[model samples]
Target: MTTPANRWRDTPDRYGLISRLLHWLTAAQVILLFGVLLAWKGFGEHPVTLLLARIGPHGSLGAMLLVTTLLRAIWAYRQRHHRPPRPPGVGGLLARSVHLAFYTLLILIPALAILRQYGRGGHLIFYGMELLPEAEREIAWMMAPADLLHSPLAWLLLALIAGHVAMALAHRLWLKDGILARMLGSPQATRDT
Candidate 1:
């Protein structure tokens, strides 16, 4: 019953409009964050990097990402019983595992970073909104997890994303399945008959 115009809700064969938007929006944010991090690491604080950092720092963006991931998780859970069936056998299991990891890291990485931010005894102002008030002193316990895991976990997330993309492309181009089209192509074009 899902037509092109009514693609706002998910069908068994394809993701709905809202889900697609959220997925792409999250992807864009992740790419932007990666770019900023790479620039900061490579250039070591040039004026341009500083300006970019001030304009779109990791903490604020991470907060945004955290919110997006939470909303996406809720949406996915609500639609869980309505979506297309996973492929059977090992492919299905692998797909499920990758999705689980992605969701876990998406929520945890920024959460840990945010904890670390507040633990450093500094106020966090995200796009002019005050998220955390300044602390009196650095809290070692609060900061430790992020200091140890945030960057490494983020890199792992990036690797998973790479694999995800590769698998999507393989599904579309090599396997000749419509997996990528379910998310990216016209819903009508990929609709189950």
Candidate 2:
């Protein structure tokens, strides 16, 4: 029942409880982050302003997300993932590459988003509490280009997330590969039978 991910038992791909907890927590946070993005864009017109006003400026939120993303990315590369063996062929390699890309985009986009705001002379408020800006307001003049980069890059990350979800569904419904289970469900999910 073990996947290639876990094959190297000596390597510790079987995450400790704390690491697993962090992994799942960050995963949920990332999903919520996307929801926040959706609301921000969708509500850009009228009544949504009320909600966003309450949610507060994105500079702080994006900065917080960027920090969390960096921490998670560091934790991930620092450990191993206990994955199962492939059925064969290029599909396995493709799956692994996609997984890596997900991690990459999550880290990159959040950081870039913050940089975009920073360029606008705004500082991260950290959940509405006033915080000093990392750089001079004068530097926001340079952030304009970052805004241009942040928008299109955001969409690209969205596409990557969609593909990630699609692969999970495909593994669960069609391939019967247990790809989704490896992270969400314990290996014992199959063995319990």
Candidate 3:
């Protein structure tokens, strides 16, 4: 009874609508964030980055991503026992490790950024609304982890995602498995077992 309209919950055989939405939505946001960063680095204050800055700053995007990431994590926990079975082997272990890393970085990067923002006496503002008020003075200790890890960790996350996509492609093309289809296609399109 997993019709397209009613696939909001996950099944043991495939992902449901909510998971797919969160997955793709988060992917899009991360891609945009990377694009903005790349543009900022290559063309420091180019019109495109300036225009995007006007619409929403990178901080706001990170906050939004954090929210989505939390929701995804919660959903994943609730569905932990309901997800598809992994193929038992080293590949499975690697997949699980990558997923754990993804979840960790998704939560950690923004968290570190928020901490750094606070330590620097800057408010954590989202869409121009203040979430965390600025501290009266800079706290070097609060800001150190972000200073050392944020950029590097973000790049590592991007690399992991690239590998994740490559594996999914491998599942679709080389393995002839329906792993990718579970996220991208209807129930009928995926292999049930």
Candidate 4:
């Protein structure tokens, strides 16, 4: 039987509890952030949009996501050797590339926002507590990357997320290869990989 401690660490076949928790939590946050943005764009000044806004302010959610993504990335690196092996050939390469892209955007999107915030001499507030103090003056250079790339990169990240979800569903429903199960199922679950 797997011990309680063992359940918290990755094995060669499946992700551990911490990894799964982080993955799902991050997914939830992303969904909420995007959903709110979409609702605001679609509904204008509707009550539902206001409610969603109250639930998750973009800046606060972005800050939280930045911290979560950093932690998840660190944990993934530590668990890399213990996690399940990837498929061979181009399949593995594609998988790695997509994942790397996800991490890149996940880290960069909020980082750029924070950089822009700092450049504007604004405090970085998360859940009402200030993390970064206001600056003395706006630094145009520091804000330029975000000003130019933030919206476009955010749209790209959303597209990537959609593709990621579709692939996971394909694995679960069509392929029946247990790739999705490796992340969603219990550690004891048997996976082909």
Candidate 5:
């Protein structure tokens, strides 16, 4: 049986509760953010899209995502030595590179957005809380990086996420590997793998 302590911390065979929680939470936020964007693009100014926009404004969702990603990164670093091992050889190298990129983009995307928002001299409201008051003048340099790269980088991040999901599914269905189980299954299920 999985002990209480083991459930909250990473093991060599499976992810701990905290890790799983953060992972899934982050995934949910990403999906919601993307869904809103896609809906806006596809449906234009439909009532449903307008409602979604109000409920989950782009800035608010991005702020939440940024916080979650940062927390996940910190937890992952702490659990680095205890988490499940990566695949051997070339697969491991590729996995490592992809993960590094994932972390980089996850942090960068929202960070750039926040920077841009501030540069525009607009008040920053996160979940009804005012985080930044409006400035007297816009800072062009502060906004430049995000204005130039935000959309392009966002598209690239989407592509990376797609590849990540495909690989996970491939591992579970085609390779019959326990990789998916490591994160999705109970500790007992992964211990034997």
Candidate 6:
């Protein structure tokens, strides 16, 4: 198999180098994790317990998302480096904030969930090994705040993702703007298209 070139294009340039990679990669992980979580929760399984069982083996993958999210956040702070289209205004600012929140919650949700499990004498499976802690916990009371954070914030993330997709579509249809295309390498009419 051949490797793809470092992809770029002028006009509302494709989310820049780092942003594009982080955007898609985080998207995939979020969707997978979203499915795992919704399946577990919608079925009335204790979300934490269910995740501890299912997502336990995917610890490293989750960690990767965390790292990627951080890197993406940093890149987002300096997006002008790629010199893309004109940035968004107040509306865009709000939308961007929502997206950032979504990313943050994704990282915190799994991490705290796992740590909650560990603190509560639960098993974490990574690479098919029962990745349990060797050190014992003296206090058994765990999963309290993690459980509190799980449901409500999860619902919030659901809304954010929905709105994000809707905004992208709005940009495509209503705004007739370059928002979506720029992210996907559509040919633009101008350098800052």
Which regions of candidate 4 are displaced past 4 Å?
A: 187-193
User: Model 2 shows how many backbone clashes?
Assistant: 12
TM-score for all models, in order of appearance: 0.91, 0.72, 0.93, 0.93, 0.95, 0.70
Q: Model 2: runs farther than 4 Å from truth?
A: 1-20, 45-49, 52-57, 81-89, 134-137, 188-193
* Per-model lDDT: 0.86, 0.61, 0.86, 0.89, 0.88, 0.65
Model 1 per-residue lDDT tens digits across residues 2-58: 576758767777788888988998998899889889889999879978887877788
RMSD of 1: 2.4
| Candidate with best TM-score | 5
lDDT of 2: 0.61
Give RMSD (Å) of candidate 3 vs. truth.
Answer: 2.1
Task: Estimate the overall C-alpha local distance difference test score of candidate 5.
Answer: 0.88
RMSD, model 6, all Cα superposed? 5.4
**What range of 10 consecutive residues in model 1 has the weakest lDDT sum?**
184-193
Candidate 1's TM-score reads 0.91
TM-score of candidate 4 relative to the true fold: 0.93
Error of 3 at 170 (Å): 1.1
**Residues 1-193, model 5: lDDT tens digits:** 5688788988877889999999899898888888889999999999999998888889999999999999999999999998988889999999999999988988999999999999999988998999989878999998999999989999998999999999988887788778888788455344334
* Candidate 1 Cα deviation (angstroms), residue 188: 8.6
Clashing pairs in 6: 12-193
4 against 5, candidate with superior TM-score: 5
Q: What is the clash count for each candidate, in the order shown?
A: 0, 12, 0, 0, 0, 1
For model 6, how does the per-residue alpha-carbon lDDT over 14-130 read when each residue is reduced to its tens digit? 554456667898888777666765566577567565665465334655655677787777767766555454556887678667766876887787676677777676676555666
Clashing pairs in 3: none
What TM-score would candidate 6 get against the native? 0.70
Instruction: State residue 77's C-alpha deviation in candidate 3, in Å.
Output: 0.5
Candidate 3: Cα lDDT at 44: 94
